[model samples]
Target: MLSRISKKNLLVAAGVFVVGSLIGVGLFTFVYAKGISYLGNDPATCANCHVMEGHYDAWLAGSHANVATCNDCHAPHDNIVSKYYVKADNGFWHGLKFTTGQYPENIEIRDSNRAVTNEACLYCHSEFTSDMRMTAGSDQISCTRCHSDVGHRKR
Candidate 1:
């Protein structure tokens, strides 16, 4: 002997649930598309988050702004193997840091990784043959440390 709700009431409840789900899906899709495009862009991408505004501003003021984006210099990427490795490692580190709310105010590119960045520079600057080492005295060393002209270029 159980009491049941009216058919009209059940139908109305189901309709409301479906409508709510559709709206949520639409909102999520919109935000996701916007976020993806922003992160992939040269300017809007950097401005998407407050943490990178300083670097973005400096890059805009620098000589390299015309040539490269923040991802070009800081993000690890290249051929399939190298690109996969860098992207995975960076993704993991950033994901972990982001989830923990431990955003780094300052980050330094490793010297070993700088060698890879240098190779990319040399790929574009095939004419330049001389080798450059990360300056011994500097705490942070990378392509930009010496050749500030090009965000991803070598001197």
Candidate 2:
């Protein structure tokens, strides 16, 4: 029976097997990685990776622990769409880095994330920042420049 099968049929079977195997492995990896946790606002989810343990611990000891979670300070507050967009974008890059073990020893925020964090700072402290914004004119100020440890104080 195998000898009678056409070459085209064998190729089709091999292709299907490869595609199915890839999808199966991908889904298994996702489930094993706790992929769904990334969608929520729970700060504990951020600590799923060992690399984030320090940051999570710091946040627990930091001033913002009583008032904010990781997303509150690191994600955009403009709207739900932008908030999730940043989360998904960051999630993808973080997943890639963690999987490849290619991240820096001392992780630093990217410029785009810094902008989101600055916006978050402004959003929370608008009353205090409004006057400062006006005085600065066209220049934009970075909140983390001076208050970098507010969200992740060293324990």
Candidate 3:
């Protein structure tokens, strides 16, 4: 019961198992214990799949494109240290989800991070003295109540 081919196959299988296991364990520990936000640091992170191209394109086209980035606006910048942490954690989670195939692989991608996005939007738009809250009159326009769909759709 000695076959060189069989032995070689066993070794290959073992190697693959080790690699896969390491990846899984690493993601689980990092995400579950720490948080998700280190993966988006790399520009290529979102480009791994083809669907992100649309959002990326829209950003560049918009007026806020040059002034901000995907994170600059989506994430909270209350403090310098906190801002960094959020970005890192968000990136990590994204990487974990995508690598483990937890993401909706075939579905169209949208603004999934609503909390962060809403805060960011308010941060910038709050400064503008415009009619955001639309009530009975044109002057009474609250952005959050009406056009709250800016991030993750107004719930």
lDDT of each: 0.60, 0.90, 0.58
How far residue 40's Cα lies from its native spot in candidate 3, in Å, is 9.5
Of models 1 and 3, which has the larger TM-score?
1
Give candidate 1 regions above 4 Å deviation: 1-35, 38-43, 75-81, 111-113, 130-145, 148-155
Per-candidate TM equals: 0.52, 0.89, 0.49
Q: Which residue ranges in model 2 land beyond 4 Å of their true spot? A: 1-5, 134-138
Better of 1 and 3 by lDDT: 1
The digit string of per-residue lDDT tens for model 3 on 95-122 reads 5676577776443423445556555666
**Highest-scoring model, lDDT:** 2
Please state every model's RMSD to the true fold in angstroms.
7.4, 2.4, 9.4
Residue 81's lDDT in candidate 2: 98
**lDDT of residue 26 for candidate 3:** 83
lDDT of model number 1: 0.60
